[model samples]
Each structure stands twice: as C-alpha cells, then as structure tokens.
Target: MVYKMSVYYRATMCITLMLLLLNLCEKGYGVNLRDMQVPCEEVYMVKEGETLNSISEKCGDPFIIEENPHINDPDDVFPGLIIKITPFRLYSYKF
Candidate 1:
C-alpha cells in the first residue's frame, strides 16, 4: 500500500509539472522575438518621403549613419538608396 501511494504521488507531481509548463507556454512566457526589440530588416531601401530619422524609428535601428558610412549626408538620403541597418540588440549580441 505504501509503494502504491508513492507511485501515485510521483505521477501526480509529474502531471502537475507538465501542466505548469503547458500553462506557461500557452501564456507566451518565453524567449519570443516578437516580444523583443528586433530589427525589421537588415538591408533597407530608402522610400520616397522617408528620412533617416523616420526609418530609424520604423526599423528600430537608431544608428543608421554609423552602420552605413557611405551615407555622407543624413539629409541627402533619396528614394532607392540602400542602407545597412543593425539593431542595437543584435549589435550588442555580436560582441
């Protein structure tokens, strides 16, 4: 009778742990990229009426000029100009 009770207690603990893990997963409590500040894209093309400031805000890349040294003038960004965007989170991970 004691052995049987021990077995049942172990099974109950296992089930409780499994249910807790499932509940956490269902609640989205994990390392989700969407929940983090990730960059929208690595390479971005300048669109009409879009400035570096606007792109930085939209893409989550604050240092646009630093990433793309070719951008001589921040104000000279024109449509179709390609630029490299590295989000601060990704940049920090590299080091």
Candidate 2:
C-alpha cells in the first residue's frame, strides 16, 4: 500500500542520514566532538632519559607543570608514568 511505501521511504531516509553523519564523524568530525566533552585529556607515557620539562616541551604545553598539580615532584617523574595533560584541541584536529 502507499502507507507502507511511505513508511519504508522514511525509514530509508533516516538510515541514510545516520550513515552520512557517522561517516563524516569517523573521518574527522568525531574527534572534534570528542574533544569537546568533559574529562578528555591526553595520556603521555614518560620515556627513558626524559624529564618532565622535556616531555612538556615536546607536547607543546609549556606550562604543563603548573597545569598538572597531580605530579607531586617534577624531579620524581620516571619512565612508565602517565602524565595527564589538560584537554587540548589543535586547529587541525578540529573538524
């Protein structure tokens, strides 16, 4: 019947829209949206022979020491420590 066809068409249109959105997001938009949400921070693993300052410099966040108060001692940082930096969204990273 016409009603059944219309329902099918609507369902198909909705599915197509959802697929397009998902594809766009997966390609790039998803990360941008993810960065907006709370508790999103980069987890950096300390490498051997690397200091906090050096790591922070590599990360491009100069004031990382002040930002991460969780680090009890700057000098005490060692390999395998996961330093959590504040949420950062690069211009290129955003959609």
Candidate 3:
C-alpha cells in the first residue's frame, strides 16, 4: 500500500509539472501568437535621407504603404518612425 501511494504521488507531481511547463511555453515575449498569423512582420527604423518612397523602392514592393498604416502620408514620413515591414517569406511555422 505504501509503495502504491508513493507511485501515485510521483505520477501526480509529474503531470502537474508537465502542465506548468506547457503553460509557460505558450507565452512568448508578450506578443500574441494569433496576430502573427496574418503576416510575418519585420521592424525597421527610419534613417536620415530615407523616405517612404525610398524604403519601398529599396524593398521592391509598394505594399509597404498598405502594411504601414501608421504612416499617414508616405511623403510625410519623418525620421524615427518605426514602421512595420513585411518581407516575402518562403515558409512559416508556429513555435
């Protein structure tokens, strides 16, 4: 009876530990995993002499205008505007 109780206690503790680990694994960097399902985004900082036109041209995609809604005006972008950039991705997977 004592051996059976010990085995049962160990099993319960192991299951609890596994569940705790799984819960911790779900939260990553405070970013919602669902938001990233729409697009794979990159962070880019505005630099001197860099305009929205220039950045889009460099990226070879005018879609930056659509992706970056914070930029009210492409021409009106100023230095230090943190814009969201989506690069062409070959594949994506969940962590």
Instruction: Give one clash count per candidate, in the order shown.
Output: 0, 0, 0
lDDT of 1 by residue, 19-63 (tens): 997777666666444445656667888999999999998887788
Best by TM-score: 1
Q: Give candidate 2's TM-score.
A: 0.45
lDDT by residue for model 3 (1-95), tens? 99999999999999999888777657543444445442334787888899877877665556888987877877887788898777653333345
Candidate 3 clashing pairs? Answer: none
Computed on alpha carbons, the lDDT of every model, listed in order, comes to 0.81, 0.75, 0.72
Per-residue CA lDDT of candidate 2, range 1-95, in tens?
99999999999999999999888877886465555543334777788999987876666667768877888899998888887766554443645
Among all candidates shown, the one with the greatest lDDT: 1
Error in Å for residue 65 of model 2: 1.6
Q: Is candidate 2 or candidate 3 better by lDDT?
A: 2
TM-score on alpha carbons, each prediction:
0.61, 0.45, 0.46
Could you list the CA RMSD of all candidates, in the order they appear?
Answer: 7.4, 6.4, 9.5
What lDDT, from 0 to 1, does candidate 1 have? 0.81
